[model samples]
Target: MSCTTAHAHELYQLYASHLIKRDIWDVKRSVMEQRFQFDPFAPQISCAGIHEHHKILDDLGDEMVVINQAYTRLWPAAQRDCTYLTSRRRVDDTDIYAVINYSVNHPDDHIPASFVRASAEVGMVCESVIRPQCTETSLDALTRQDIQTKIYYQAKISPGGWVPAAVVRETSKREYPKFLHQLGKGCTEHFSDRPLDCSTVKKAFESRPPPAE
Candidate 1:
């Protein structure tokens, strides 16, 4: 089969073993096309190492490992911190409720505000899968703004969730790195069959363990 983007093909080759084993190739394929296509000169931005296509694959493998580890599961369950923001989107009540429920059940074991923000964005895109009307393109300017606010708040409220305010502010701006913009596009294209990858790597944002005194 033809590849969606160079990055997607590279990712398939890189993690073909694990992806096929998990039966996650289908989801990864779309993620590749929409989010992983590499761009050398496309603005240099990195959100938990997902700024480029190759890194996205790295994150997926790492995240899967982290998810399976018992130690990693000790983190508290996710919270309803963004309710204030999600409440505004009356049209997206179903998704909002779903997100709230998921957050409560699955606490983020890993603690990197950037990655948390990234995850929230990914969750929103996933929600769009079920609620197509809420796709990024379909959203009006105001609703989109609300989502940004929600993303930032979600990250802010999480334990040890203190990412730079600039990063939060940047989410609302129009001039993001090319890869992010494309990811946003992918989030909206809901039915596109392009090879995509959405799994993220925890090591990318892994805080270093304290050095021996």
Candidate 2:
């Protein structure tokens, strides 16, 4: 299942539109603003490598697009929420991200602590299960030669972490201007273009229904 760059962007746009129609951005933005307490329009915001409010929304939208697009290219038998957001870091250099949570599909399947990191980041996202070493049996040790060979093989075929760069560029060209317009309009009307504290947003959402799938 190989997905072309064009198809991936199209899939992203479709899901992204669904999310916007449902006011997903508003829901997230309300909470995010409250938590971060940063002004989106401040020049200092850009200097910190943090995207302003609109860009954050676009990134989330972009991530959804990538996940769904990647799904179309995955083996049909592969069944799991491909979308994950990292949440915690453990002492062993293994980080934990949401295995699945807070989505309409697969409701009640909020399994955490499933995904584990084996080593440092590779340029691509790939997973393979390794059996735990047992005290009773000594495992054969391999040096740099063996590890290098494995890395070469895996990286050669991996998708290089996300959708192709060309797809991202094209998607932005088509979608970003409209997104920016909407964000500006929305902020002006609702927030007066100010960033809010997360506590307010969190309480507000506490009463509303959970975000859509």
- Give per-candidate clash totals: 13, 4
lDDT values for all models: 0.24, 0.24
Give the range of the ten consecutive residues with the poorest summed lDDT in model 2: 148-157
Compared with the true structure, model 1 gives a TM-score of: 0.22
Please name the candidate that would achieve the greatest TM-score relative to the true structure.
Answer: 1
Over 4 Å off, model 2: 1-19, 22-162, 191-213
TM-score of each: 0.22, 0.21
Q: Cα deviation in Å at residue 196, candidate 2?
A: 13
